[model samples]
Target: MRTFYLLSLLLFALASCQQPAQYISNEGYIYGTIYHVTYESPQGKDLQPEIEAVMMELNQSMSTFDSTSTISKVNKNEPTELDELFITIFKQAQKISELTDGAFDITVAPMVNVWGFGFKNKEQVTPQLIDSLKQLVGYQKVHLENGQLMKDHPNTMLDASAIAKGFACDMVADYLYSQGCKNLMAEIGGEVVAKGKNAKGNYWSIGISKPDDNEFFTQQKLKAIVELQDRALATSGNYRNFYVEDGIKYAHTIDPKTGYPVQHSLLSTTVLADNCMTADAYATAFMVSGLEKSIAIAEADPEIDVYFIYSDPNGNYQTYVSPGFKKLLKKEYE
Candidate 1:
């Protein structure tokens, strides 16, 4: 799925109207793009070092790129003490996995590797191979013991790529706020968490991309736009990672229950919630659940608002929004 990084230029424009003293700079990396956090405070420079320090700690604590990360230890079945940050994120992931009926599994790493999305052999997988790989997929195989983690089964790896980035953004945002940043925007791999007002003194406006066959117009399609203060938004779509074989498209997102890539017609789903982790995980879960069930789940939860784009069996494209989501859409788009 493609996640977008957006800089609030409108906030900058508005800040200029109020004073000549405010400055903003963004920093972070997601999908080869530098995901940034725009900081606007009267004393911005003093906080830069502190922000950098927190970012460093976060990278060390959670980064999959680091072979020594807490998640890596858990996946390797090595004994390790759980940091508070790791515990918080792991709990949230586990809760979502259960709530979604294993639809949002963190232990999908093996499947991702077998499908050639990770550092695997990078070969086309056969049905027999997929079946074997599916045997290793399940949330139940992962366990959290007394202050430690244990992988109950062999080859059951953890891939927190789905929600960890967003969780990281939330943690960073919380840190920024603690550092006296009243107006800030944190984005990691297109998942965003906005706090306080933008430079314009209005909520941050984020553009949700359209699922288009042409990559050039993905951003231009602008399925929906949202303005947020103290909220996080995450979008999941099949357009970003997929392979075609025999005229069939196989997306990177795998269903843990079936151990195969989902074959839903929905192109994208965006979720807005109080935290990026929830939004991030739910976006993936809803995408796998397809249109009807996604809507049903969103309706059942007042905290979640979802926007979905699907292709009808007749080849017509349609968009569906939950009641909670309609308020966030631009009037024209709604």
Candidate 2:
């Protein structure tokens, strides 16, 4: 009788250990964009609230649109103490700016605002305006002292929208990881961090949309798809976000060097890095650097992989995929 009782307990323990893993997804709107996070949970728990809490914290720190946000106060030159999020991202931005030769400057906020893509109202842009804004657009003009951001010019502003969404994705991934999620994917807007195998025991998949412009800005066609494992991806493109005025087009991506919107054939740049923040910054830098310069820089960095989509002189789409990035493709993108 004792032996039979012991055998029953052992069998029950084995059954409990063999429980199948389930995928739990939590999705909502934050940062003015849709965020989706899915994780493999053996406990079948949804961590939407916790995930949202992290996003809210980030917004409170760096959302320029929110008057009460920390960044808003800084942009206004108000006497406000910088938060850790601001310090970290600000330093990261500086590093990327230096690495990209000032192509990824957060101090381009003044230029961005004048171009009508920032928090301020759009104005009639002119060469004189661009030249004036150039004075306040270099990353070297700002420094952090005692948790305070000191600018060379009082009007010099900072904008981290290029990297904030990607960092938010990283933050959510970090939270999920702390909660014991090994296999998961986190995406904000289009920036993503994917690690481990997915619910179906395969690496996560990310899609790159076709470079098309429209009012709604929906995902119309897939230019390509990539399988990602233990890595992050970020894409920057002007195709979906631009305005035409006076028979000329102006994209949101501003060149800090020239204080003008970039006029480049490089339609989209997708970068894969160890973290979403790095990928995001590099992707935007590539957009500002244009094709040849971006190619040279991308080749020099072994930690980054890139896939560039540009337009040929004849208006046909052309693609350039790096060797490392080529390995991640599910199949050749025709």
Which candidate has the highest TM-score of all?
A: 2
Clashes of each: 1, 0
lDDT of 2 at 281: 96
- Stretches off by above 4 angstroms in model 2 are 1-20, 118-123, 214-219, 244-249
Give per-residue CA lDDT, model 2, range 1-334, as digits (tens).
Answer: 9999999999999988774767998888998889889998766677888899999999999998899999999989999988988888998899889889999998888887786744234568788888888888899999998888898999988889999998999999998889889999999999999989887889999998878665344647888999998999999998777777697666778889997778878999999999999999999999999999999999999999999999889878899999999999986455
The deviation in Å at residue 106 for candidate 1 is 0.5
Which 10-residue window in model 2 sums to the lowest lDDT? Answer: 114-123
> Residue 284 lDDT in model 2?
98
lDDT of 2 at 41: 72
lDDT of 1 by residue, 63-165 (tens): 7777898877767777778898788877888988887878899888877777665324446767788788777778887777888777667678887778877
Query: What TM-score do all the candidates reach, one by one?
Result: 0.86, 0.90
lDDT of 1: 0.77
Give lDDT for model 2.
0.89
TM-score of 2: 0.90
lDDT of each: 0.77, 0.89
